[model samples]
Target: MLHQQVFKLALLSNALLLSIGILQNPSLVQATPSYKASNSGVPTQSARLNDTLIIPGLRFGPITRTTTYQDLVKMFGASRLSDHDVFGAEGLSRLPGTKVNLGETRSFLVAWTNNSRTEVAEVRTTGSAWKTQQGIGVGTTLTELQRILGEFEIPGFGWDYGDVVRPKQGRKFKYNIPILYLSIDLKAAKRYPSDYRAVQGETTILSSDAHLKHLGIKVGEVRVYFDQPGMTSAE
Candidate 1:
């Protein structure tokens, strides 16, 4: 009878341990990051690599005529920027310029090239696959993702931002994970030759990438995909 009691106690202890583990591992008991992102949080790091991938870009408007962040403020008066990075560089394309700096001004210029045309893309990330995955809870929402991640990296696109990312949810899927879609709109730019708009656009993308790569050891490559309106005035 004593032996039987010990065996039963052992079983109870094992059961208790299992319960504790499940409770500790929120993902196992609750939802996965992917699931949470789909439901309400940002996309998980895994979704970017293992699932359909797309980098986020900014939904830009004509700011070319405006030369400085101050100029932007004059027109916008604290208007909302589409949470994304507007940047560019030279080494990759051999453009006769240096590195692009987004932080130079809250509002900066972005250039891209289309068949000898130069233009810029306001890059944004919907949600990057984390350098590693994180636990997710059941009631995760976009607001929650913003709280935890604060910022995200886009895939194959040379842009990212802290504020622009918004979370969305849709129909459920196999893993019961919702699909999270984020926008990566290249800012809309209009041409004005007579006005002579001269804002200092970012010089190089390399520096920004370096910063992110350092920020997250396992983060992936950074590249910008933009529309080229036409080449800048040749030097």
Candidate 2:
């Protein structure tokens, strides 16, 4: 009985020491319900937040105008984000931006208001996954855009701001919300030189232009600009 008691005490002591070690070193502790690791090894909570809805003129996932670089790093693992200089419209200037997922299909660019990267000036994405609540996104056809936007205007092609959508009057989205700048480009503008020529350079081409259907135009990129003071127009 004495020997059995000693063995039991030794086992209990070893278990206690192991528990204490785990408490002292958090890395050794098993994942709790609230702190589980995702398949990619990032914390599940952060990974989940990264998939938040993309609301135009509002938020991209959990990211907003107030979101910072560190906030992005927290939502998306640091390994997935890299800093780079994004060229302003027409290659006029270079602005600091964060490239998320880089070359991946879901990749997007977040341009900062300043070098500090504490304020997001805008978010641009060509990924179809990042769609507005109205289901507008990259790959949305001209007809589809017309259906959603209900008579918008696009800048003429073959220029810096070519193909960018603009509100005909004041911000006339069919939904009556702030504009989400979409760059819709013809799949093969060069194929139909006449059609291309008709829409090139500083001209405002109405979305209802009957000729646009033959050009195979689609939303190539989507940009959400935060309403920041001194914020210039979308390029």
**By summed lDDT, which 10 consecutive residues of candidate 2 come out lowest?**
226-235
Error of 2 at 155 (Å): 1.9
Query: How high is each candidate's TM-score?
Result: 0.20, 0.69
lDDT of 1 by residue, 14-47 (tens): 3344344444445432222232233323234333
Tell me the tens digit of each residue's lDDT in model 2 across 124-203: 77777766556777778888877866787766766665566655644333331222344424456667667767776766
User: Which segments of model 2 are wrong by more than 4 Å?
Assistant: 1-52, 176-187, 228-235
Which residue pairs in candidate 2 have backbone atoms (N, alpha carbon, C) closer than 3 angstroms, thus clashing? none
Give lDDT per model, in order: 0.26, 0.60
Per-residue lDDT, model 1, residue 157, is 26
TM-score, structure 2 vs. true: 0.69
Clashes of each: 34, 0
Q: For this target, which candidate reaches the highest TM-score against the unseen true structure?
A: 2
